[model samples]
Target: MASAAATSVMGSVIGKLAAMLTEKYKLAKDVERGIRFLQEELRSMDAVLQMLAEKDDDQIDPRAKDWRSKDGGIAEEIRELKNLVSEQSERGKRYYDINQCLTASAQPVLLDPRAPALFQEASDLVGIDAPREEIIRLLKCEEKQHKVVSIYGIGGQGKTTLAMEVYHKITEAFDCRAFVSVSQTPDMKRLLRDILSQISKSDFDQSQMLETVEQLIRTVKECLKDKRIITTTRKKAVANKCCTGIAAQMYEAKPLSDEDSQRLFFTRLFFSGDDCHPDLRKVSDDILKKCCGLPLAIISIAGLLANRSKTVEVWSNVLTSISAAVEKDSPIDKMKRILLLSYFDLPHHLKSCLLYLSVFPEDYSIDCRQLILLWVAEGLIPGQDRESMEQLGRSYLNELINRSLVQPTKVGADGTTVKQCRVHDVILEFIVSKAVEDKLCYHMEW
Candidate 1:
């Protein structure tokens, strides 16, 4: 039985190799040579193994038995060949890695949905009057001192839009001003040089590369010692770090209010909320509730619905698909991609901890102690001892909160530590989808 199984496996592998050589796949010369060598070796082994399987034990020669034995023979040769294949594979990966490194060093194209909104006309924006005023008030541009305002919030909540709006409004007050968007994996030298180019006059040559980030920062600061700046980010640490040694204000961007959400949703689909059809109003409100006032989500879904039939059946089906975490559609998939920017930025362990929140129902206030214990049991949180594990788990939780991916519902008596938290429904849906898609966790609905 063992010899027959080995013969069958070898034959199957040889067939695959034969197919590969005949297929349209473009193979490198070395790889094609290796595949031919493996094909011949495997074909020979398959024939020998088949003959050995057909023969009785007494009829088999001792040499053939030796070849089948584990000590050294055909099995040993196969093992050595496997090791050789692995080594070649590793070499190929290393070659690709070098090319990837070169690609990484080049300027990355910005594909972020929010990046273009920085240049959007203020007239095209909705629900900005209040937050815009608040941020501008925090800036206190009238003061002689250079002030920095950092706006932060959950992804898709319009932090970038608000900052850009305020920047345009008060930019004239300062002689030298620049609006730069920092990415998750920022190129510091390029970023600093960008700032310098924006604020510096024509004397600033964009062609000359700066030697170092620190030198660029000194040059930028020297150029803008009296300039006011507005910054926006999702991570609180980033906000705080950028505001260091400067008079700074941290403004958390708020979701559009219900009225504004309706306005935005309808304005994208129709002339205004008043123009919404009677049949679509209820479904629109339902969709808005699921959106949770997220401007990007609202606009995306509304834009999708605008192109399709505006019937209750179609709209309701869309909402139902969202509830079911169905990403087969384009708009929802795009929104998931956009909102998952925060999730993609997380470290591996924090990502696991964040996805585990999908186990809870949406808007469920999770107890910190219970969540930490579960995380430890699931091997999501790593540490040596129970106390240390729990401590580490809490830190992971705090990091997620700091990134604006999770929300704190209850705090400890010290008023600093988060004791309970909840994941927003919009975020939870994507987390559940991601968790299931990656096979990291099984999501079972009750």
Candidate 2:
């Protein structure tokens, strides 16, 4: 009987202790005593149950069973403890508004999808408004020319995004417009039919789709007399085909400046350029620096850091992970896709040349002549004696530049020859990753 009473008391004490632990409730000396008592009583009751379980069935009959192990009891101690616990729970429930508790307790807030994002703030953060406006202005010009403009940049540098912005801004002025991806190895008939149908707002049947390439080209020429269409591609070779009459004017999408890079790093993370947490400032800055102002890199890394606690130790580990990723070819998933597309598009010879160049440290400018000599020495330059090895190497460099994979650092006065070139840091990381994946090279840490 005494032991059963103790179990009831312990149950009540545990309930009260749980209430006290809630921040909204007060913890008094009596509450502490109740918790301690509850723990001790639980230990004793556990031993009792264990003993009962082990004892012979004859020794542990219904009469020997206590109230805890029995069906029911209304003894004063049991009844009183139950009442106390019920009353305490009712009081706690009155004070605990779930919504209020959640709002007050959460740290490092999350975005609510119900609210619309500030897109102008984004355009401002990434500093794309000027270029976007310029593209729009050029597209809307009243010149008699075809006015086809091709926007170019390394992968993940927001070429498509900037072009989309311009496309939207000026599409209404054209007779009809459609934006479509002309992926590598597009079927010319289908490709031209899609462009013609979209620009003229006509849907072609299967029979119409069988029209000759010359007929499709004529349709494009006729529709584009005053109307305009925009297409994006990874290579200038592809862009030239999109233009039927004159070559398209090329607008290069430059990487963000340092100031814009910082703003973009913070904007995507916190949705505001301001409001960086104090503890995260240094680590956030470090992460942004590694991004090399590439939109995809900055945005992907920011998404990762935002979910994590803003502690130096945690962020430092992420920094180390990014460094290891560069060595192991395991960059963030978004960056991997962008870079892999560019790397795969290269010809076999260019692929070897690009991967070999990855051996240079990030951001090191390669003199065209010297890089050509190195390629020639390694027998990487492709030829059947059609051109000298050095000339072939420079031709490879020029081709890569036109494809926007290799950025020319120093151009001759005529802008025809690239004297020096350098890979963007993001591309360098990707090339290193490819090299590691293919077992072509492995990085060593000092």
Candidate 3:
């Protein structure tokens, strides 16, 4: 009996030992898996830390610190970790949304079906109050049968607005229509790509410049073979006009008419929707004469007047400042110096590009594609070490347009492409004078 009892005890003890060994092995595996998961999570956190460091340098507040500070129990800690992930995801989404909004807003014109027209007859186009018959006559004279008629002028002188007005008026007569703003320095390849992309409504490899250009020209020729096209530029080159099959007729868009100037001045001075001040009108007429009908000058003077007390004395003071500036040299020269104040405010890279524009001839309508290519060639745009040169160039162009230093003359029908650009004659002349002053260009005597 004693022997049998001892055997049973030994069996029980062996079974217990086996169970303990299995349990210990299972625990070890669970611990190993947990360690691996924690290691992966730590690596993810390290990546987030690196991103946070970059954001900190940019002056953005880091949210990781807040997450680290949250207190939780064992189960709560796991939940909090999940919440942290969700929070980071939300933050990334917000950042993307903000970036997109900024990009959309920074563009000169964002084309949307719901967006308002470029010109609000009363609010946008200054000096457009002339008799409808006279205005239509001028536009009709600008019309061409088989060629593209480009109206060139200084920036902010209503070139695009005028073109928009004409486009809205005459688009019905053509089979197809396109409006493009060529704001960047002229590049044949980029221009072709833009034309093709807009026409086809598809993305393309812009790096394939030659192929893109050929494709664009072929597409444009095919599509607009019978359509009347209007393009604009700020670079004085006959080459751009000849690229497409259409013959190009150039129109030097003069400044606003004197009557239009007077209207613009008064509108700016007494913008409170009140009755007109005849005295202010008289003063504004004098200011208009000083403006020499340049819409940009008129607008600038008007902007100055709008910020001050609406009194003849204030207008007189503004006129005196302008007159003093004018007495220094030609109105165009004075305008350049005045406009330089705005240029001085640009970032360094943009300043270089703006100055580089002086290489082109006076009253030249610039092709955006060619301009960007030239910038890339000049090393004005940084390469992949930063943003790609093309992106930087485009950003520079956008900045100039936003500052009203460069104006869009033609926007492609697709609404995203800028076909041509024209600096205001006043601004162009200013650029030329600056170039001469800096000895960047020489005037050769024949």
Query: Which candidate number maximizes lDDT?
Result: 1
RMSD of 2: 22.1
Q: Report lDDT (CA) for all predictions.
A: 0.69, 0.63, 0.56
TM per candidate comes to 0.48, 0.46, 0.45
Which 10-residue window in model 3 sums to the lowest lDDT?
111-120
Model 2: how far residue 178 lies from native, Å: 1.9
Better of 1 and 3 by lDDT: 1
Error of 1 at 385 (Å): 68
Cα-lDDT of candidate 2:
0.63
Better of 1 and 2 by TM-score: 1
Error of 1 at 354 (Å): 27
The C-alpha stretches of model 1 lying farther than 4 A from their native spots are 1-120, 202-210, 326-446
lDDT-wise, the better of 2 and 3 is 2
lDDT of 2 by residue, 1-446 (tens): 44445554555655565665665643445776775676567556645744555566568767656533552343354556657767876776666566357535634222221111213233453678898887776666565556677776666677766877777777666656776654334567877777756655563443285558887777666666755546565566766666646645667777777888877677656666567778878877776666666776765465455555767898888777665545444334446653554456567988888888877865567898888888877778743342455676776766565444566666666546667877756677788888898887888753
TM-score of 3: 0.45
In model 1, the Cα lDDT at residue 90 comes to 58
lDDT for position 231 in model 2? 59
